[model samples]
Target: MLVMLTGAFGNLGMATAEALVRAGHDVRALDLDTKISRARAAELQRTAARAGINLDVRFGDIRDATYVRHAVLACDAVIHHAAILPPTTEHSPELARAINVGGTECVLRALEELRTPGRLIFPSSVSVHGPRLHERPPVTAATPTRGTDEYTRGKIACEEMIRASRVPWVITRVGVSPDPGASSVTLDTLRMLFRISPKNRIEYVHRDDVARAMAAAVTCDQALGKTLMLGGGKGCRITHYDLIQTLFDALGLGRVPFDAFGDESYYTDWMDTDEAQRLLNFQSGRFEDYQAELAARMRPIRLGLRPGRRALRWGFLSLVRPR
Candidate 1:
């Protein structure tokens, strides 16, 4: 199979690309012409060579219909992971819509024009369910989508467009994916942690697990035309307070003061992924595995930051008061 993976340099996209190659499929890795993408492309080439796999790296915007059409041609499937996520999406609504919504349209059009339309594996977000009250049930594919943010709204629109199209589609609503390699104990991260309500539930899915899900969905005939909820299973589900404290302890930082944290306003909750797991067989990671990875990465900086941990916490609190 020859697969086109947009945002191939991104955390999820890179994982998916590697997984596809490992599964004996060639990948057309497409992304924007940026410095990061260029650097990652070189790394991807090295990695692919080491694995004895074929990888074609292409650079262009997803919003460009001509580029998208060219990329979509001759591909057996497409795994779309390109999007402007929040915080960034919140600040640039128009750009988010152009990329997330319009970009998807371009892909669908390209696929429609093909004599043999290929399957589309769209990685949507659980955020489309909107902010859930604490007592709400675990979200399923049947949950109503009520996204107030531009990013979530764009995702909803994209999902609808795919469903309405003639193409075979698999929509997987994913949970939070924190890159373990990028995890660090920073002031800004601490501030964000302080703001999250300790009681709110969050599902943390590993990137590799998410990649496996995408790869599985690509070939799984049963997954066609299905909207699945992809999560990390029971071992990855936890409350915000538990997640923070685990990270803090792993990094040699003490537990966060309960009084200092505020109620979370952002959308996040545990998902019912039983059906998805049965169909795709992609759950292979646990939250503890992620914490261990994070701890390993933090070892080098732990000693240097240990002495200033208290100061860092106080500084973060002073910079942003919890709501």
Candidate 2:
């Protein structure tokens, strides 16, 4: 299959592209012509060369209807993973809507023009469930969507559009799938972490697992017209406090301070991914694996910062909580 993947240079997109190529599918990877995108594209090319994978990378924005149409027409399947995430979405809601909702509309229109439209594998988010008020039943594909923020709302809108479209589609409401290699315990990240409630339940899925689910969606007949919740399975479910503590421990930063955490609920929650796992068979990664990967990446920095742990904590607290 010739697959056209939007946001092809993104963490999930790149992983999915690699998975597809390894599965004997030709990939037409598309993303913006930004510096980050270009760097990722180059890295992908080098990686593909070593792996003997076929990848045709294109640089363009998803909002370009003509370019999107051309790309869609040339491919047998579409994996839509392009979207502005939080902080960015919160900062620029209009741009988020333009790229997320408008871009999806462009793809759907392009598909509508085709005599034999290809399947669209849309990656939605668990944020569509919005802020959980109380502990309830595990969220499933059947759960009603009530997205609170712009990013999650955009995802919900895109999912609705896909559901109403004539194109064959599979919607995967993915949980938090952070790239272990891309994470750093920076001040900004620390500030964001401090805002999250300690008691909030969060499920994490590895990017590789997400890639596998995306690849399976391309040819799995059982996935068509279904909304699957993609999670990291039993081993990946953890409270926010546990997740932060694990990261702190991995970085040799000891225990996270209790005062740093907020009481407000976060937008993430545990998901029921049994149906998705049964259909796509993509849940193989564990949180322990991710923690190990993060630990390995942070080992050098951990060594450098171990002596200044107390000073670093004090500085971070002073900045996060003035006076």
C-alpha lDDT score of every prediction, in listed order: 0.87, 0.86
What are the clashing pairs of model 1?
197-264
What value does the lDDT take at residue 115 in candidate 2? 94
Q: Residue 294 lDDT in model 2?
A: 86
Which residue window of length 10 is worst by lDDT in model 1? 182-191
Residues 99-176 of candidate 2 have per-residue lDDT tens digits of 999999998999989999999999999889877637584788888888888998999999999999899999999998
C-alpha lDDT of candidate 2 relative to the true structure: 0.86
lDDT of 1 by residue, 172-206 (tens): 99998888787434556567767877887889898
TM-score of 2: 0.94
